[model samples]
Target chain A: MAIPLIQFINVSKNFGESHVLKGLNLSIYKGEITAVIGKSGTGKSVLLKHIIGLVQQDSGQILIEGQPLSQLSPKKIKLFYQKLSYMFQDNALFDFMNIYDNIALPLVENSRFPKDQVNKKVLKRMDQLGLIDIEKKFPSQLSGGMRKRVALARALVMDPEIVLFDEPTTGLDPIRKKKVHSMIQEYQKKFEFTAVIVSHDIPEIFNVVQRIALLDDGIIKFEGTKKDILDSQSKILNDFIAGKDI
Target chain B: MLNKLIEKFGEKTINLLKSFGRIILFCFSGVTNIFTLPFQFAKIIEHMWFIGTKSIFVIILTGLFTGMVLGLQGYYSLVKVGSEAALGAAVSLTLISELGPVFTAIMVTARAGSSMAAEIGVMRISEQIDALKTMHINPVRFLFSPRIIAAAISFPLLTALFDVVGIFGGFISGSMMLGINKHVYMDTVIQSVKIHDINVGFYKAFAFALVTTTICCYRGYYTHLYSGFGARGVSLSTTNAVVHSCIAIFIFDYIITFFWV
Candidate 1:
């Protein structure tokens, strides 16, 4: 039980009359890849958002490393952000910035690192991700897979302790999907950071995440290891495992 | 049929009111967030370059041409009234009271406002805004404030540039093109255009800057209200940003004039 790095305690959220998350309770252990799987609009991404205090739960608590998110002031929240990174579904690189600048933004904004150091660090990360050639290219110029890798590189640039991935393989082809999954695994191993991934692509994610949480109708219907997910007799889990309506 | 129509219209009107209310609330919260956060001088400089330096050429070109046209038109109209010497006064007054602020605002709304909406809209769609929140970064301070502050500072300066260039254009037209005495043209402008006229333009520019930035940021900030993604949504937000900001500028301009006069 290594003091679960993140916890959602009966967290709930509603968008108007429609509830997105319903009394959800889950904990994410450090250095583990936790996959949140559900059909579209089942609040997988919303749950990931709550963990990082992106969206406050309507009536519950979210704790990161034993500290409640709501209690932290805005300044403290910014400090907390330094320890977390997010990989957006669309790889939301500032289109105005070149890839090198995009990856260097957090460092330049938050860290005490000077320009030369930021450049060196960015180039080193880019090299690790095989993105050295596209350093000057904007996000629009990169392929979907390349964009995802660049986003991952940017997320890792700060050496964050937690990384949230929102649909890392949504629009990619099978080859690219595999590549993204492998990248996720590689980064998780190298950084030893808690990785919380939201994706409907269960099969691909199953190969990477240590544990899986199945969300249905705004609730966590089941939570267990990959073996438990594969062996479950629950109908909702069955449909999900069978790749029906995913 | 009348009842049904009233119901439909009532619903739409209420929704519109709600939207307006939300925009005001968002602006207030954004302002508060900016104050709550620690000042980042580097971010301010980055935005000044983006919002001010980048927009200079367009603003200058727009101002120059507007002045020239105003001068030519005013000269002809004053001549028709047998007061051709009043050309400079009319041109200067109109530029300072109206064109300088209004046209500059419209240009900014089209150039920066639309892009602001699109940028934030994309961030909304991509959940980068959420990422910021999760990272404990107030999107307002991180994203919105810089633009608002930049626009606030730039709009008045740009409007002054517009007035200067416009007045010069009028001088050039009255003296060189219309064959009016340079002294007469200069005297009319000096006599009629008081400090208050320039002050009015500056005030309006400030108001327009606030209106345009608020509308654009509000439109983009709450983009989740819109369903769907891709080019259509982005285009819708861009149009909304420009149109709403323009309308807001005009509406505020009227309000300010009502008081300032």
Candidate 2:
């Protein structure tokens, strides 16, 4: 078997009295979409944050490409970060910056790209994402779906090795949610980047993701392909999938 | 009961010390980043516009009125002592030595400092700062350093402007409104303001700049840890930043004046 692109070894986290994650172990492969599904406030987002170094685990190890994250040298860590992109639940676009500048920030800050080259890259991404005319418009000026597109464009602008999505279809209507999932699928194929999506979209998400992980009570209770999960005889996983209050 | 009181006091003291330690570290990070290479000139210039250029009108208005008041009062007191010719010396000296830097700092605290706190607080609550961090942009360098650089450069300059406008206001009130000869007033003003006095004013302005900007930025940067969340948290952070910065400015003013004197 190939080495997992990312692996969590008995990770744990606590916020004050609440234990958000407890000895949670998981692995993610390169060039595939893995969905982590759990009910609200079950630390699904915290788990995603841990993967991106936004939130630190209390114990255990997170290894990226067979190397433990905490052990990397500063320069190597910078390289690690360069390979990662996170799409926040809020989009987190700089409200003061217009769409073009927003999309160009990572490039402009990370590299000394000439203005024209930066412009070309941003415009190309904008064009591909159907965000051409709205380049000058601020994130606040755009509609929900359009803002989502801008976020995706900015995330993909760096051509990172891994992308983590935190509820990308949140607060959208059904049709828009489907569109967003489809957008994610299309982009993942086009870019061939490894993806870890934290979501609760259930059956709709099952179709989009290759594998599923069910998290409850601070541990991943199930991990397998969608077909495997559907055929498995796990009561807790079944109850969660059926939307029953466990 | 007494032990419980002592314990509670100890806890509070430790918490206060920790808070102070954090503030010092945060300010140190911002100050050190100001010297980091590949300087953030664009953001620094933008902050200078926000902190300095936008503050010109309010500084001028405050300086003029303060000087006018000093002239009116100084003229009356000097006439009683048969030294009304010394009115120019009195107003200019008071302004250059004390009021110019202090009032400019307070006015700036009310204007730009509050805005900095509120803006950063909003960004913190909204996770925009985290977004920057994830983008590999240091939030302290991107947000606070530019503001600190702007404040360090702008405060002394604004204090100088305040002193000049105030001296002019005194001239309007004394030489033009009253019967003091213009040349005598101008001469007394020129003779009274030693370079040391101007230095004292500027030193105070520089100190106030660091104190106010650090406190405001520190308060806003740590808004997530405060007692509230969301809008109320932001409001609390802004309020604490402005109130604490103003208080800190006065405290540092006294310390600097004590040492300089």
Best model number under DockQ? 2
In model 1 chain A, which range of ten residues has the least summed lDDT? A48-57
Q: Could you tell me which 10 consecutive residues in candidate 1 chain B have the lowest summed lDDT?
A: B129-138
In angstroms, give how far residue B82 of model 2 lies from its true place. Answer: 2.0
Model 2 C-alpha lDDT per residue in residues B95-207, reported as the tens digit of each score: 99889999999999889998898888888887788888777888898889989999999999999999999999998899899889999999998888888888999999999
lDDT of 1 by residue, A25-104 (tens): 88888899999888887888788767665677899888767888788788876667667888877777777789988888
True contacts kept of 2: 0.48
Q: In TM-score terms, which candidate is top?
A: 2
lDDT of 1 by residue, B1-261 (tens): 999999999999999999989988877876676665357666668877777778889987877788788878888888888999888898889989888899989987888888889888888887777656544456777788777777888889888888888888888778888899999988998999999988999999988988899889888877768535666777788788888888888899899999996
lDDT of residue A100 for candidate 1: 88
Error of 1 at B134 (Å): 3.5
